[model samples]
Target: MQLDRTRIVVRQRGVLDTLDLALHVLRVYLAPLMIAMALGALPLMLINHLLIAWMLPDADNLLDIPARYLWHMTILIFLQAPLASVFATTYLGQAVFHDRPRLTEVVREVRKVAPRILWSLVLIRGVGAAWLLLLSADRYGEFDSFVDTFLPLVLVTWAIGLRSFRPFIGEIILLEQNPLVGRDAETITVGRRSRMLHGPASGDLFLRWWTSAGTAILLTGTVYGTMLFLVGVLTNDWRQGRGMLLVAYPAAIWTVATYLTVFRFLTYLDARIRQEGWEVELRVRAEASRLVAWLVVAASVMCWTTDAFARESTDPIEAGRQALSAGPSYPWYDKQEDGLRPVHVQPARESALNRGSRWQAATEDPQRESSWGTSVLNALAQGLRWLGLIGLIALLVALTVLMARAFLMREEPGSDDQQAARGLSPLEADRIDNLPFSITQPPKDLLAEAQRCYQQGDLNQAMIYLFSYQLLALDRHDLIRLTRGKTNRQYLAELAAQPGLQRLLRPSMVAFEEVFFGKHRLTLERFEGCWQNLDTFHEDLQRLVTP
Candidate 1:
């Protein structure tokens, strides 16, 4: 595997950038990732069905099973998430280096570390114990506040805290192959490595965890909502059937969980890049390897050149014939009736060239078919390695272009605060303390303020203003019921019936994410695009209000 030539660009990335990039990655490796996740999750799903889903069979209410199972399943999946990610994490570890690890290889790698995983994730992290807890609650639907509620609540809270601060333990054990126990004081054990990796960046990891959790929740809801819509449309029924409870619901959860596995891996890479200068180390090691490869090639060429010279000096005729023919030389001896006879004698120094041409000789000789097959296999392997390198380069280039666009625009610190302070009603100030636009402002005034911000070259603030205007205009037209804590995607999903409004808000939301969450400087091109969309949106709002 090549150290420098990775499938993704090795660099420090903000939480949003990493999250965005994971979508592209999911598309590329969807099949394998899905398979890996399913392989890990299926057994656990079966076990939970028997333990939790079956426990509430005698509950009085018909909806008890669905509610009880989903509630228990949510906590179980959260606790078992790291365990379920073992296969995917191992596969991604090899994939990052552009190596296409086979299924058996991934399984074997996980199997080798099964003991450690069980110890650290299952026993110590209480993954198995969580299952046993649910099992111990014998009457699952009884809803004992402590056994059914407080216990699982405490488990989930602990999981959130542990996973948020140290989310990449699966990667550490599976990818880094850190020993569970240190052999000596100099050696780093898994515990020590976790601290070393997570200690300095604890705060950032916690923030990223909240961001990822929010995104995951949104994605899960979107997917589950889509599933419900499809079921209703296809069957003309909206009831929560057994299939929905047993399959669709869990599928949605696992699907989002699978995607987050990729997100988590990217975060791990980002953390390493920030804390360890891992990209620099990869580059240095890659350069050293390239230098070695070049030196070997040069030495081989010199040896071939000197050997040719030696042959020419000793036997000019044979040397000329061999150079012109560019084929393997015959053996010095031939089998004859009398015995081995000298057929075409050549100097011993020229024999190395003959040895090097053994592959060609084997292919020409039908009797040595196995040797020929071996040669073909070796060539194919080399070709695959080269293809991996090419893919690595291409992926790097694509990710670089994407990151360039995502990170180009950054907001000036306190720009929003300064803008918000200028014109404020006390009520508006209290509502949106840092937002540059009043929630109560007319859409036209918000648009004008955004224009002034752009005119003043505060592109980021301008984009925020445009985004704010979008929400204001939508709220005024009664397109959406705007509320705090609702995401832009949620708003877009709400406007799904209005293609015109959805079209305008979609790209604006992307720009909004880059400016607000990504903290990128809004470029002129992006600002203009948002400006156009908002202008069109404002016109649409006027038509709606006028009618």
Candidate 2:
């Protein structure tokens, strides 16, 4: 329950760092994570396949039906990814605290908040609405534009937009366990917490989501492609088959989704660290807890030993009277010597001082003597108790001061400063500073810059400028978005729906990747070839734009 005792260090991390850390977390908890993910996703996958299986022809030779089933299931998985991640999210919450919760424990924890998950993710967010709609259409391939295409498009767009702004709903619902609708103003409902956590950083969240989406798409493709290549080599079957569609493709997608689930959890932590000074709060709370524990132990020991140091008198009469008067109070000697010293038995001296404390004791007390060591010991114990109290107060003050400083300086080393340090332009820096590569310049200037680079025979620079111009142009037309997080492969995937554009743009993208990423030498002929492809793509883009 100690926040400061997390497996990972509590601190702010950049988007890419979060991604990398997610990978690390996944590896560390791979077994439990896989078990949790499988438990949640397998049933949903089966349900999805069953719902759409009827749309496929009953004929055993229907590859197209199975392929369609595959794509539909892929989309279904994307929609339901957050829902499936519920188990992983719960397990990772415990994993963050270095606890390897059993699958039963994860399920139990999830069961406690099942209604919230249902209401927030399934009912309110509509994660499962598409499937529910699909359930009504008893036939497949009867593609009504509204029912099959437009409705799904609208649903997807709405979901994406909603999720882009508020992707941590699963974490909030399952992990935080906030009430759906708080009855009082002081209570923070799930909705309010989501707004409070995500509101200030909306732009940041979008960029992070944008970047993560691009990366996830690329990863899914890479995984799927690898699986295809392996299948082809092993069985000489390059065509999409039942196994490829139903098994390989979904596996690839789910693999990436599981990793992304971990990534989202980390981002949640980072957001808390940023907006709420969560790391500071954890440390302060932990220190305060320890202080209180120490105080309890010290008080317990003092109380436990109190009876052993009861005050005594040489006169039994006086002692009896003192004990009688001491009724409900602590031992009399507790007030002296800090109540920690053992009895010092003075040898029976014919001293009248110890005989009586009434009229005779007043005059006899001055005649009695005490050892210097005893006086020094008593003073030291009393001084130590006072010092202990003062130290506890000082510790509390220091913790308060530290928390204040952390809050005040949380925004230090501002984003602009980080961008500047990385040598990125304002525009490029603002997009995502943690991206491995800076995005292309705006389309208006990049084409001319590419031409200039070509003229100067700086082929590498030319290729980069050319590629940037291409991406920026696509982005301008809303055909595909340009993000620093995206790579050549991701862009190609984005343009998959438009075969014409993709075909024309393919050569240039490949050439750019070769000369830029593959570190291949760019010959004059190759540069000219890339240019030719760009011209064709530009012409097509203009036509598309005009139309």
Candidate 3:
């Protein structure tokens, strides 16, 4: 019988399409998985509520209070980090495979890598706990104590944990699926040991991590401060009483602050994994279509659920009742010397108090009428105030939705033909084409021609040629004066001052200009030197000018 080589080739081709289809399915299903994850957390939230009730059984009117406040605190301690890790891992897997992973594939991958994820959580929590303990031990002046005792230790610990956890988890997830390393006990054990020590040993890593964390913290603090200022303005309650500020405002601020901080750290980890190929193992395990669906669904459900709960809990009637209770009250009735007084009428003329009542009414009624103007003004002012508030809220919602839609759309990688066919406008195409080191032909051809001219012992010709090339390379506005026969040194100086160009081309451009403008003589030696410099300049320029 003849060996059937074509059968083997056909089988391989079959698997390739199957994998692509699987990835497409995974991408489509990620949203639903995300929804399921949020829904899954609801039981845990209920349990937390039960625990809170058990702990404080005597507290009255508990149902009226929002459940989220209590559950959020509990979830943060037990569930938030793990959930975030899962989501981050899923994102990495999707990114690495360049397709959506199936939900079952993601879950299985997550299960296999769960130990690693748990280990990361342990490392983070351990470091955080230790830092908190050290902070608590310090009994110096308040702000100084926080800075000296807490900040340094926390910063160091966080930097170390982040650097280690990101690469380690990524490695575990990516490497877990190899046929050679498949979920086998011995391979996993070896992998775990390797992952435990992947963090940066150098000082530079710490500095980078610290700078990223510090910037995030500063931004979060600034946002919180701004929000508090806005709240103070809206409430018209400028006094910062510790009870109200600490219990309600500060807790809310801190929660949001921590969420943003963790989000930033996750983004940093993503960048590191993308740059370093740390997510290869996870990608191998990821089933594309399911994973995508899971992410999209989970995120969407969580957002919707949270929004719905917020809307339901914000009762306008309750708000109005609270506002009324907070204001002064008036008596329903009053008594006089003769009998029970009718608040709207004077006493009968037969009574001794009639004359006194008449005098009192005459004197005080005008004053009361004058005072009524203040009440009318106050009511009108309150009405206008609510109108402005309603308008402001509508405006904010519109802006938020616009921004969310702008940022949240999925962007898939496209083919070159597809991109070209989009046929962008000239200015837009120029911007895209000019993106640095993009491997298109214009800059490369220009540089090659300049190098050839320089090698032929025509220094003046080379300078003019390269200068003209530079003029054509720049945006139209930058080349306007050059085209008009103006050798504007100031314009060149301005270009030189641009930080990116300065970093890439300053040395070569400076040398070239000196030789071109009679500041330096051209000899065989100088020509060779300028040629070498210009070659390097061309290389840099090619990097800058290529699409």
Candidate 4:
């Protein structure tokens, strides 16, 4: 046997390390668990999408919007809850136990935990729905116009603050030991969840949750949104988009749901290791087992001593004498035939001359010791080879970086080429009469004329005049010397320098650009809103400049 001694040492890990281990574990299981969850949620998603396609009203149909939203809400609560519970329960099991999660086991666990999961979901969803109603109050005419913008801002800020220490309600369902059947468990579970979340390790727990679940939600949304765009493009039919979500929504569900459930499990373990001194407890338990073994041996020796004395005479003095006569029973192995025997290492019986010759033979043998390993020339050659490899790698990396820089830094087209291709760049100024839309406005009445064009259903003409009015106003206000070849951004920058005009017309310009050149469909609501804002700003400017 080769006598090569190697050792692997394990030590107690602190919060960050424990979390790192859990993250590595999660990474290994992310794919299998995701696959299982996606498959489980697939059927529900398909049904939801199919129903939505059949029942959802056209965007223009204001009367049916409320009914459509009600249908969506019904599906979200009843159907989405079960699908979510399956993913959460399954991933939690995998994270807690470090096992490859199976969909069948997930179903079994879901049955046991179903009520709690449903209640947890209901509480979360109910609060969110209340917030939605408050924010969407604009549609039903229940709140001031300002509330539409203000409430959503407040809600976003509140959500961000809440994430700092979001209640660990899910942890309650996962960690409770044989929790009571119904209401009692729910009450106790929430209390325990609160305790765990507020403990000393809560900061680490929140960071872990944000890093895993928060990031997953963002990435999942981006991936699914991109897929939806591609699918819409390939099919050339936006109406059939609902059917495509059957596949897409599963990917989204798999990412965010699985991450959130697994995060709860990791946090639970981190809290235990930090608060319970789990490593010390394990070492103490092992020492206790050793102590018990020694006690057993001591008691057996006493019994043997007492028996010997009893067989001879019943006196304490006699027991000591009998013990000496009986001698040591243990190690009892020495007295048994099959017991372990001491190895009596044999000494070399060879003479000094013979041993010397054998030693020389071994030292000279190439098989016993390689001269090449220690040779100066060979060592130099090996070092040179390693240096050569390193240089080659560095050269390849340098080349790659240089190539990327060159590609990015290539020269763009000239002003002449740009103007030739598109008449004028969006940034450039042009003749008033050369405007794309036909207009009946002199310079002084451009604002009133733009409004008339807008009222007459000529959105394109309206946006052009609105945009032109802003540029002409800025030029007269001496904000900048207008250029025939100026870009939209240059016009914006020129206006932004004037605090009065910047405050008034900056937003209007952006709205103008979106309508003037962007592909967004011009709806009546958006059209009216933009027109009113621009008109209000135009009126304010006239008052500001008119002395």
lDDT for model 3, please: 0.44
Candidate 4 lDDT (Cα, whole model)? 0.53
User: Can you tell me which runs of candidate 1 are displaced by over 4 Å?
Assistant: 55-65, 306-547
TM-score of 4: 0.37
Q: What is the per-residue lDDT of model 2 for residues 1-547, given as tens digits with 9 covering 90 to 100?
A: 6658889889999998999999999999998898899988999889887877665544544244464565567678888889999999999887877676777888999999998988877766666778777887748346566766666677778778878999899999888999999895336688767776677678899999989999999999999999989988998877766667667888999999999999999999898777556676679888988889899999999986575455533576566556755665443445333343456667754447657544433342355477899899989999999999999999999999999999878546574665566565676434333332454333336678789989998988888778777776676687887654455556676798889888767767656655554456677887887787876787888888785
By lDDT, the better pick of 3 and 4 is: 4
Per-prediction TM-score: 0.55, 0.53, 0.28, 0.37
Candidate no. 2 TM-score: 0.53
Candidate 2 stretches greater than 4 Å from native: 1-3, 54-67, 138-141, 289-547
Question: Model 4: residues >4 Å from true position, as ranges?
Answer: 1-23, 30-32, 35-106, 125-164, 177-189, 196-214, 221-246, 286-547
Task: Write model 4 residue lDDT over 1-547, tens digit each, in one string.
Answer: 1111101112345545544655665577667666665655566555545444444344433233334434343334232433354555555644443334566666676567667665654344343443344434434344353544454445444544443465344455544523424373123345343443344455765676566545655766687677767876887654423333434555555555555545445555555544444444445565777788889999999999789767875677565456654677544335444344565678776665557575533333356454765687778999999999999999999999999988766435463464456444334324453333333424345667678978888776666677777666666666655654444555555565456666555545545545543433455664565566665666766776789
Candidate 1 local accuracy as lDDT?
0.77
**Best TM-score goes to which candidate?**
1
RMSD of each: 23.3, 27.2, 27.9, 28.1
| TM-score between candidate 3 and the true structure | 0.28
| Cα displacement (Å) at residue 244, model 1 | 0.4
Cα deviation at 268, candidate 3, in Å, is 7.0
